[model samples]
Target: MKTRFGKLVCVCAALCLLLSAMFAAGCGNDAHQKKIALVFSHEPQRWTDGAQMMKESLESDGMAVDLLIFHTDEEQAAMLTQAVDEKPDCIVLAGGDIKNFRDSLEKAKEQHIPIVDYDGLTQDTDAVSYYVTFDNYGVGEAMGKYIVQKMNLRTGGGPYSIEFFSGSDTDSNAKLMYQGAYDVLNPYLESGQLRVPSGQSDYAASAIKNWDGKNAEARMKELVANHYQSQPLDIVVAASDGIAYGVIDGLAGYGGTWPLITGQDADKKALGCIQSGKMAFSIQKDPAVLNQKCIRMIKAVVDGSQPEINDVTTYNNGVITVPTYLCLPRIIDKDNLSAVSK
Candidate 1:
């Protein structure tokens, strides 16, 4: 009878241990289920390689990420309405489309939802709690400096004209990049070392591509058809490598391959183009690093800490530049392609 009692006690102890284990597992799963809502102004299907990397990196953090993709400001507003309704713990927006749903975001703010912005920046919206981005003007300056130095344009006897292809006008990054390049090349243009004849034509022949590669290509074809000059284009200052690829396609079969083309993004195809000497340089940005910085910012907010901004200023465009968190932008050419890859 004593042995039977001993066995019964052992069984009871084992049952208690099993129950405790189950409870611990449940607690862990619950802890891992924190929901984060990621709202994008652009469709996820058409997101750039950098944006796609960010999504993957966020998913690896053992939290649930609910991505609501939108293609237009109107679509973004509608999605923001829905996301606010869902009452997510955190909201991540791609850009300044914050204005589209300022009211809805205020509602989120009332509910204590933390907001993070990436890609493009937004202004003094109470809804935008944090901002993440690279140095837009600096990126362009880097590209411009590389081109000027590489091509030996300052000592040029032969004329070289770079066709500037900008991104979406609505995006602040596009404007800064274009202006930065202009600042770098303008001096040379005035000195008769670098030529931009298209400037005299009201820049009508040149086009703003809205960051679309196909659009850039179409515009390049139009320039080629116009036969703007007897000389071949010496440089194509593409806003992104994706657009650079399109420009290359448009300039195809023009009797001879054109001169140096500059692009940003350091995309795989862009790297390939560099290897083939079709592209002069690409700016390398690691989305993984950017994602890690964003995660840190979000976690800081969640931990009841405020993010540090380098400097905050309001641009004339009414867009507020909150603390600048600019990442390192590297210059990539054929020699450095392998170093910048995944």
Candidate 2:
């Protein structure tokens, strides 16, 4: 009877040890999970897609992600402050205006939280560790190159009347894109092959506030009424699809052939317009490519490894040169629309 009782006591002790070990393993897994804070300034479809993809990808890697979207600069600043207070392992920011978050970013720096600046460029570099984006200059160059090829500008075929519509002046990417387009078009403009009837070639003159389609539409109407009444407007270098659509709306009842237009962001409506021959082409910055790069970078930072960087010299955020990964953008036209759609 005594031997049987001792055996039972030993068996119970073994069971308790096993249960404790299992509980410890569960807590270990929980401790290993990383947390991330993702913030976006706007809810455009592309950005929404990016947010979803990033969340899914990070969660799949055993990380917890909090997504925050804001509409105004003030709102974004507040959101960033809140995110910093949460003390996540990493923060991903996509904002049109970065200067507004200077104080919040400083707090993030104090807490040693890594920041990945996505899409939008910023002047704050001390806290921003990595930058992931499609090549803005390349996007502009593609647009300008498409216009040049279509207009036969290099082959001396264009004495075309062209109008320029640029993105918001506040966006750094907008300026880079405009520069890329202008660099390609300037030679022709100097040679009189491309004439700006309104003489608004400068970025400041052509910039649309906040990239608003309505504002672009209004400007397009004013330009058409003032300058294009006699001569045909042969080409339009619109920096984005919104601007392109505005140009299309402004020209609805002008009773002339549609001009060859260049735009960025392969918006669905813009693609339909391309198919119907209303607009020329647009540059598509694939969100999946950018999101994957961001995920890899975020994971690397969380794991205490150096993330992959392709370009380090191009992106200087006022304070320091940021390590950057640039994804190339592709041109989407009627001929290649089905390929991209698939």
Best by TM-score: 2
Q: How close is candidate 1 to the true structure, as a TM-score?
A: 0.79
Could you estimate the TM-score for every candidate? 0.79, 0.90
Error of 1 at 291 (Å): 0.5
- In order, the Cα lDDT scores of the candidates are 0.72, 0.88
lDDT of 2 at 276: 87
Name the 10 consecutive residues with the lowest summed lDDT in model 2. Answer: 40-49
In candidate 1, which residue ranges exceed 4 Å CA deviation?
Answer: 1-34, 41-63, 71-75, 95-103, 109-112, 123-126, 156-158, 200-207, 314-319
Backbone clashes in model 1, listed as residue pairs: 123-320
The CA root-mean-square deviation of candidate 2, after full C-alpha superposition on the true structure, stands at 2.8
Tens-digit lDDT track for model 2 on 1-342?
899999999999999999999999999989768999999877457887898889998998789999998898888988999999989999999865767888888889999999999987777558889999989988888888888888888889879898899999987788989999999989999999999989899999999988888999999999889987777999999988988989899987576667998888888888998898988898898898999999999999999999999999988877898899999999999889998764
